[model samples]
Target: MAWGPQSTPDYRFGRSKNTQRYSAPPGVTLLGYASPEGAGDAIHHYLRDHEAQVRRGQQVVRAVQQLINQGITPDITVTHPAWGEALFLKTLLPKAHHIQYCEFYYQNQGADIDFDPEYPSSIDGHYRSLCRNATQLLSLTQTDACISPTQWQCSRYPIEYQHKIKVVHEGVNTLFLTHKHWPTKSLRCSIILLILLTWAKRHAKRLLNASTSKPLPYPSGLI
Candidate 1:
């Protein structure tokens, strides 16, 4: 069971393309969210009213609940930290193992604070506060497993939660990089062909000039 942004092409390219191809073990089931209307509108509606968003999230969790209600217990359910707050898997998924893939905790802890200069201070402050609250909620949760791509990210969690955190290095495939050399070879071939064409053009021009300047051959009968 995986929760977070739904699996789309962009997210697939960003997050899982290489790993899925190279590192993922056989028989791994990648469960992702699917909304009837799609995730964009749902996320937009979620951001507007957090309380309503929490309710809606609970409804989403209930769908998972139905699977468990039918006695199908998944081995692991990985969720993004953003969706962690809305999902109460401890209560909802008591038997199944819950894991969270920690990304960033949104707050003003020395991170850049670039915003629209035209916006009033009050609006900025409200937005900042909302971000802080979301981060706070993410940090407070307890789960069976937590994984981070880097050690630095794993350190961001609370000391108690750190024991549960595991550092898994994301894998990379060199196949694409190797395939890139073929294009470079192709480019070099193209350059060489262009140079040869230029030389041929010059040679043809010289032959044409030489032929035009040379004396014409006389007819043997007239001579």
Candidate 2:
């Protein structure tokens, strides 16, 4: 967890800097690094988030190095590409099968940002939004393959790289739903949009109806 809540300083990335091995899950190891102060706070700089990810990756590299020192090398490495800890991972584990999750790719205009006049997107904002996808693009080259949740979502990626992404939706487990068993947690995973007042007013009415309606009967998870 190089750049998430776990990696925040004064948090799970404790001063101990020790590798966390979970016994309950038996041999499940988790490595966390302290994210640099103000690492993700800036949006004006195009490389701002990417640079932060590289800094966090350095710490992860050191942690993995310790394992390498012990002659412990993994045959596979599952990572979140957006976290930036994956920056130098291929260099470190050249032979490992690396898999990254492919969520929605961002764009400055026509997609999420600059879609409405009420909420104007500045040139800097557009640049930042477009530039934020740098890490994802680099990951496309570095990773062995990718996993996407939906065909429509997978289609959002570049045409050439779409082949690398396999759609694996987390469909509701019907048996589990029938049994009323539900998992307590789901790890990280959204869309952004701008609104015109006319559409917003119509959407609000529909939203109210949706909100008042009963929640979905099924949750995503193991069957």
What does the lDDT read for residue 152 in candidate 2?
69
Candidate 1 on 95-204: residue-level lDDT in tens? 65667776544433322222324322355655754554453354247467778777766675557677877898564446654755555332222221121221235355
Tens digits of per-residue lDDT, candidate 2, 1-223, equal 2221223221112112443443223333455555444456555478888877767667767776776696666656656676675777789888877778886777666656676565688888878887888887876789888898778668877898888888997666576677446446654321224323223463465545544465533442211
Best prediction by TM-score: 2
C-alpha positional error of residue 196 in candidate 2 after TM-score superposition, expressed in Å: 20
- Each prediction's RMSD to truth: 19.5, 10.5
Give the alpha-carbon lDDT of every model. Answer: 0.48, 0.63
